[model samples]
Target: MQTRTALSLVAIAALTACASQPMRAPFSQADLPAAVQVPAGHTVVMETAAAGDITYQCRAKKDMAGQFEWVFVGPDAGLKDRSGKVIGKYYGPPATWENNDGSKVTATQLAVAPNGAANIPLQLVKANPAMGMGAMQGVSYIQRVATVSGIAPASTCAKANEGANQLVRYTADYIFYKAM
Candidate 1:
């Protein structure tokens, strides 16, 4: 019947429209803590889900003899796209993000807010000028949000444990933005 064919065409057209539109980001800055929110005039250029471990070492607390604590060493993570394909890596003492194209960026911490008692804090960082080119070019800011379980070990850090290292598992969403 003509009516049935018309309805089928309408459905096909609707699906085509949706397929052609760019995908929207899964995150919303308005729902995030203010300290970690990216400033206006920037638009998301890339978003990645990072999974890996943070290394910490037990060391004497600064300015406080006879006390010890866990100090952050660095992070090592594989960055994945929304559908779970590894696109890059995140690592370093200098905190670097590198894409498959060999482009990279190192950023300075701007601010942080508590995520939860059992998780690492959400963070915002101002990106330094990118190195190389490709995906990292023009990146202005990077926000670490939706953190899970990156906190330092809760075990006692005593003189006996000095210099001992621990690797804590964590996952987070790293969203990179560029000036619009």
Candidate 2:
């Protein structure tokens, strides 16, 4: 009977220690490009994986008459937690991140660094004041990394296809940070 009680105590102590450990961040900023790294004085508050499409349209290149290329229109993605549960969405012309609770933030691009020729660039954005009072309440910065295949279509973008829209699927991890 005494042995059983001692074993129970040990098990409880182990569980307590585990519960006190801090949650590990999903990704390390050191592995990311400097231009896309979150600034100091901020701590990660949320991390989500975004999976969706980027819309691009064929348009005449500015100041380069007779030349046409694909221009980024915007993104439409579902933001999911590590377990793949749908939590929010990211979309826009104005570049918005919205939680299911109706809280949202619009942000301006701060910097971008190349990921690869076949992938879209990794980016950093400064979030504007959030609109509601949920998960985005104090978000200061958002980093878009781990990008996969959001590049423009490889097809010809001649004048014949002007205004044609193409959707390129992509997956990326968006890490949200707040002032510490």
Candidate 3:
């Protein structure tokens, strides 16, 4: 009986181990979806995730109150899943440059990687949609002043492309827009 019990325990342990084994995150950076057409003066910066996903950022303006938050002009920002469904939109609280209190940038869309993950660990947030159902994601847009040190990454580290602010850490996929 003792031997039987030991065998069962071993089997349970093995199953537990298998369940917890980590897999390399399965996300990859694809070309930006075609629907997202930044104007002639705009450029998109892609942030590659080690696991296989990409994030994007855009240039934006601050409101008169010194906060720059999305007011949802028409619809929430939209994103497509790998299978090409309009999976979800990106939302977050207001942000600003590290100083001066008013340079705000908002996340407009997220690729909505499956399994509620970014292919890596990330700081996340979201809002309540009508039914109290909402979505969240790793931030794709962020704001920083030219004076804010360390927004750029060092060239040699494994995660050299990552940055940390007083509030969050993320890899930036930037989009620079200019007028034609």
Candidate 4:
């Protein structure tokens, strides 16, 4: 029984170590679905898990019958690897990547899909070389995929929460690609 317990503890420790390391694997570009377009010469360099909120603020839409509605402004999330080290962050102007090494890149949307029953969309993102370095050095694109959860309540447009910030929890995979 003592030997069995020792082995179990070792197994658990190994799993924990594997779960806490940063992921720097090369992902196959071909694995990307047709919806995610890789720019010419770009290849997937790293893939991280993003767990955070899609922030919303109640605002008066220009054409929504004078009623306020929840508008998706941006994401406030932490980016982690399979090993669980925080590699970056997502926030600002619809989409952005800020790495731990002080590299930051804002992306332009190339393709998007209506994700599910929710009204929000999933996106294919591209970054500029001039915008980042270090961990994000040379990164040219990212695909937001494998989304499991994260969408704001449609009922939040009510007067009670008007002009206030709301955070909708979500999780997704962020695959980073670089120009090779």
Clashes of each: 0, 0, 8, 1
**Segments of candidate 1 deviating more than 4 angstroms:** 1-26
**Deviation in angstroms for 16 in model 2?**
12
Cα-lDDT of candidate 3: 0.29
Once fitted onto the true fold, the runs of candidate 3 whose alpha carbons sit more than 4 angstroms away are 1-30, 40-92, 97-117, 120-169
lDDT of 4 by residue, 63-101 (tens): 876688778878888999877999889887746788888
lDDT value, residue 27 of candidate 4 = 62
Encode model 3's per-residue lDDT on 1-180: one tens digit a residue. Answer: 999999999999999998997764432223333233332332223222111112222213344333222222211223343334544332233321111122223443423222223222122212112222222222233211111111222222222222211221232222322223
lDDT of 2 by residue, 24-135 (tens): 7556799887888888899988989999999999999999989999999999999998768999999999899999989999999999999999999999999999999999
Off by over 4 Å in 4: 1-33, 118-120, 130-132
Model-by-model lDDT, in order?
0.95, 0.94, 0.29, 0.78
TM-scores, each model vs. reference: 0.87, 0.86, 0.21, 0.76
**lDDT against true structure, model 2:** 0.94
Q: State candidate 2's TM-score.
A: 0.86
Range of the 10 consecutive residues with the lowest summed lDDT in candidate 1: 24-33
lDDT for each residue of candidate 1 in 21-82, tens digit (9 for 90 to 100)? 89875567998889889999999988899999999999999999999999999999999977
- Among the numbered candidates, top lDDT falls to 1
Clashing pairs in 1: none
